[model samples]
Target: MKKYSPELINKLTDKARLLRCHVVEMIARAESGHPGGSLSAADMIAALFFHKLRHDPLKPDWADRDRMLFSKGHAAPLWYAALGECGYFPKSEFARLRECGSILQGHPDMLKTPGVNMSSGSLGQGLSIANGMALAGRIDGKDYRVYVLLGDGEIQEGQIWEAAMAAGHYSLDNLCAVLDFNGLQIDGRLQDVMNPEPIPEKWRAFGWNVIEIDGHDMSQILAAYDDAGEVKGMPTIVIGKTVKGKGVSFMEHAIGFHGVAPTEEECKQALEELGCG
Candidate 1:
């Protein structure tokens, strides 16, 4: 594994915190959005946008740029924040999230959004789309890689399994996936809703290179990305055990916050806790 310097790790860590702040503020402003999953995936997303993925914010449609597909698109707040922070669009656009006629929709729209590579809102289809992108890269002689983020709950969809099977069968080494395994979904705990346990083993059985890590740990997250890149024949999945509503004292592990946006007071508290207030 390639060792990352302390300076780099701290920069990524700060970036993740900033992303969380953006997520909370955007959801609170919209008065409707998913916070739990967005917070859960913030660290991983930050790592990708800041360090792992190869893309130019100045040229959002750069043909050879690496693609990022958010399979669990309810976390649009998180995705939008990353893009804005990366200069895909003005950060001021975050205020219009979910508003009628805004480019920053409730879910990703590739045509409208500058950095989003896929138009994804329906769960369980991201991996299939990613598979196509990866395969296209291979055929076009482009070395760009595809990265997709999956929700633990979203994987319950039958289509996710089908995509998994196809990715394994094709040995898509250029494709990497990260599972935001924060345990809880909108309804409740994943185990109670529909268990997708033994996640790592299941992916391995399907011919993926599985690397499990603490999703919040910058070191492990960075290392997992490095490890995934080295795998040659099969696709790799980094199963990150993350905390829902991470960085907020009250929201962490609170299932009620899943699909609900924070009220003004709650948003104040969350921003304060994130050191953004």
Candidate 2:
């Protein structure tokens, strides 16, 4: 668990805000891509990639680096923004997102992207990979940790529970999973679709150490992440409460914004709201 100085916290927060804007503009430029969930998860990803996770941009496969898997891979924009802005690649390449032959695809592919730990698109599978990595770390006596981000709606998949059970039973304490609890999925509200509430209790019942916090608050998000580092004998789950399309006025909590790109005007409004030009 690390205590970030005020300066570092502010730097990470600034990076997060920029990442949020990048997400919106990238989606708007592509005229396609998931924005709601990606925007919602930006702060947490920023906190991880900038301050919490231990990885080298130049050495993407560094043996001792912490691992992060995006379970809800539709939000690749946010992840790509973090990677590029944090110096994994030239930020200019971001404009080429989703283009033919571009490494930045609709979802993360470890083979293509320099910093992505794995190729992910299917729901409910990232945690399983995270668990495997944690187990391998244990067997090889490596100090690396594994983290995975899961969507609130994606939790309805039966495979998630199976992976949860396996992670708990194995006591993969080196593993941490975060739920992007924006409360909305692609179709509609999660409760209206399939409720994943009682989320913390459910994880605890499956033998994980659970905590809930505001996903957008840098302090709270950092605290939750640091706490995850201290849990020694159990997997940890941080249920991050967030609003979909958080920075844009019309998009917040709007299910229609889930997979849709914003208009040019909407992009201007969103960037303005984010305090950008």
Candidate 3:
């Protein structure tokens, strides 16, 4: 977790922007899928997949590699985008998203997706799987880490806390959790739907080292990642305050955009805005 050179940070940011563009394009083409949450998590996923996670695209089953569970499985577009961009699959597969026989579904399926560590999209179950992975890594004496992404709304699931308690009890310091705190969920504002306030304090109380930062700031995000790696005795939580539907003016902060796909014209505009059309 050493500091990333400014050049490396810039490269990560650029990759994140492309990740966002890919999410938009995939969703627009499929005419279905979650875009807001996916867009919000672009930088975080890019940082982990492209820079932090010790994963091999060629050997998806590398035993000692880090494990990443996307608990908010509706963000499959983003995950698939990253994996495709990472060379796990051909880029052409992105256009077939959600289509019959396509590996990229509305939610993640580990059995089908080469790089997906756990089948997710159940909303509250990913943390448990991540906990198991971390515990297994510890038992096997492996240095691999476990990373999970949770939605702001997904935190309302009581199981998240249950898993949090378990991680604390086991002192799984190798487990790192990232919350895409975009503040908006499918129905409306998360505060109105279900609030997860004092989020960092809650994690701290659960025996976690919390690092809160702007999720889109590559520099701060990378630094926070290094900070998470340095902690001992407990898990680390990163409350990444991000903009829902980031990089697209119309979709930013709009709850309606959560599960809606962009129109052809909108996609063009969005891609143009991201400079990746």
Candidate 2, superposed: residue stretches over 4 Å from native = 1-4
Give the distance in Å from residue 228's predicted Cα in candidate 3 to where it truly belongs.
0.7
Instruction: Assess the local accuracy of residue 139 in candidate 1 as a C-alpha lDDT between 0 and 100.
Output: 94
Q: Rate the local accuracy (lDDT) of all candidates.
A: 0.95, 0.91, 0.92
**Residue by residue across 1-277, what tens digits does model 3's lDDT show?**
3466889988999999999999999999999999999999999999999899999999999999999989999999999999999999999999999998988877999998889989988898998889999999999999999999999899899999999999999999999999999998777887788788978888888888899999998988998888999899999989999999999999998889999999999999999999994
lDDT of 1 by residue, 1-277 (tens): 5689999999999999999999999999999999999999999999999998999999999999999999999998999999999999999999999999999999999999999999999999999999999999999999999999999999999999999999999999999999999999878999999999889988999999999999999999999998998899999999999999999988999999899999999999999999994
- TM-score list, all predictions: 0.99, 0.97, 0.98
- Deviation of model 3 at 80, angstroms: 0.4
Off by over 4 Å in 3: 1-3
Candidate 1 local lDDT, residue 143: 90
Q: Which is the leading candidate under TM-score?
A: 1
lDDT for position 191 in model 3: 79
Q: Candidate 1, overall lDDT?
A: 0.95
